[model samples]
Target: MFGGQVAEVLVNEVPEDVYLLDVREDDEWRTGHAPGAVHIPLGTLGERADEVPRDRRVYVICRSGGRSGQATMALNQAGWDAVNVAGGMQAWEHAAREMTADGEGEPRVL
Candidate 1:
């Protein structure tokens, strides 16, 4: 229902407890992602959409905005309050927002 916002400002627009859904692949997720983001690849979103909460805002992201844009449409159709994170992780990294890897070592954007 709204135009997507770039990752830099999107991080601040939503509250601290917002649901940031990362629709990237397993490998991409392991490489790096926005802290506290939930990992549910775009392909599995339909079956797993229910896992995303409704109480807070839901923002979807991918390596770029393409997959998250697709997810935003699907989630909205399924009655979720979702938005796309424009420029996705690329922008998030460019903005210097916090990024974390799978806990074993330092985070690196891939």
Candidate 2:
């Protein structure tokens, strides 16, 4: 776990039904991202926090683990159940998990 309080899970450990939030930038998101993820870049998450459901556990992710970790902490402090996807998209791609691209190219982590 990150910071000994924020929950952390590996890519393979994420449940198929969980709410996945991608906090990467626009360019990074265009490159590739999880199939069912909700795109709410970290910079705008504070204003868009209500868009995230408070009922279920939220799985936050980013290019690596850094940004997601921050998002997880913030969400948790704000009374949401959020877990950081450790190793982030890099690990997701390495594990051969499903991904989708914004454009016409093959989905890949940028």
Candidate 3:
């Protein structure tokens, strides 16, 4: 998602306190992604809520903004800090950035 890139920029430009929380699936992750991102698929987030820290700023991302938006709302309702990565990875690609994918093959769109 775009937030991944924005967070990445902030991490470099405003490298004070920001974290990237990638909510993409495992196979999606195996493709390209931002550096220093923490892998935590959306399906497992609820069970792993405690694993996410509440002490710093957090930015959420997924293949598209929809899932991330859902996660953001859920986190916010649960009193955890989270924000949606607008445009998601598709948007990021539109910006002409590099994306990772499995070297073995490409993911088939259902």
Candidate 4:
């Protein structure tokens, strides 16, 4: 719902206890992604919700805002401290950050 070059600022400003959750598919993630993101596809979120850490806040992201927003709502309903990353990966790309792939076809901090 919002857009701007605040990825770095947001990432840096958040408390160290917060976590970044990437809901994009395996293929989409393998191309590149934000640093310090956890890969958890949206389709399997229900079953994998327990995998999310309850000890900290969560910022959700996907290819765009839509899926990330949906994931945020789901997490909120499930009692996790989750928020949508507003513009998702598109915004990160717009911000000119680099993305890297991992062995599991997921993105990792680079």
Candidate 5:
């Protein structure tokens, strides 16, 4: 398994077309999230782990870094190639990455 440090990446470091997993709650997701990201709240990850792809690297993100860090470690131990988005959506917004909301208006990190 990879070390925690090795499993973390900044928003700018994330590549294009990757499997981005947003582990925030439904309300947070509706507020804002990376475009095309898959939603799997941290609480449901254990049962939904099977839904994450096995063949490619998965980038886990949350409000900040804590939850995604936990998820990164778990997924790595479970044999999935996972990495945490170090600063989460907060960093994503700071970096000016594309974001989409669930409904009307512009997307903003919450």
Candidate 6:
């Protein structure tokens, strides 16, 4: 991986117990995201870092891989155990992983 840090994990490889952090924007998160994933828009991550669990693995994801990649690096620097969900929601959706909307209705990625 980069500079001895662990490489990002593909969506399929993420363990169920790891905390899933959805770093997309508000609307994006409301649209659809991994079931049980915590919503923390990337822009507010620094202020909400404490909301993230430091003791458990954190799998970070965004619409694509870009935002999550940045968030992953930040989380690591902040001493949180974080990994980018490679390919992000796009890949997760492609993999046919279960997803849920904010409330009810069809779950469609934005």
lDDT by candidate, in order shown: 0.80, 0.94, 0.64, 0.71, 0.91, 0.86
lDDT tens string, model 3, 23-73? Answer: 888877877555566779999999997888887756776776767777777
lDDT of each residue in 1-109, candidate 5, tens digit only: 2353547888999998999999999999998999989999999999999999999999999989888898888998899999899889999999999999999989998
Which regions of candidate 2 deviate over 4 angstroms?
none
Off by over 4 Å in 1: 1-14, 103-105
Q: Which residue pairs in candidate 3 collide?
A: 1-88, 31-100, 31-101, 32-100, 32-101
Give RMSD to native, each candidate: 3.3, 1.1, 5.9, 5.4, 2.3, 2.2
Top candidate (TM-score): 2
Could you tell me the TM-score of candidate 1? 0.84
Candidate 4, TM-score vs. the true structure? 0.76
Ranking by TM-score: 2, 5, 6, 1, 4, 3
Write candidate 2's Cα lDDT for 1-110 as tens digits.
36677789989999997899999999999999999999999999999999999999999999998999999999999999999999999999999999999989999998
> Using alpha carbons, what is the TM-score of model 5?
0.94
Q: How accurate locally is residue 82 in candidate 4, as Cα lDDT from 0 to 100?
A: 78
Query: Candidate 5, 24: how far from true, in Å?
Result: 0.2
Residue 31 C-alpha lDDT in model 1: 92
- Candidate 5 residue runs with Cα over 4 Å from true position: 1-6
The true-versus-predicted C-alpha distance at residue 21 of model 3, in Å, is 1.0
lDDT value for candidate 2? 0.94
Poorly placed runs, candidate 3 (over 4 Å): 1-17, 97-110
Best to worst by lDDT, what's the order?
2, 5, 6, 1, 4, 3
lDDT (Cα, 0-100) at 77 in candidate 5: 88
Superposed model 4: Cα runs more than 4 Å off: 1-17, 103-110
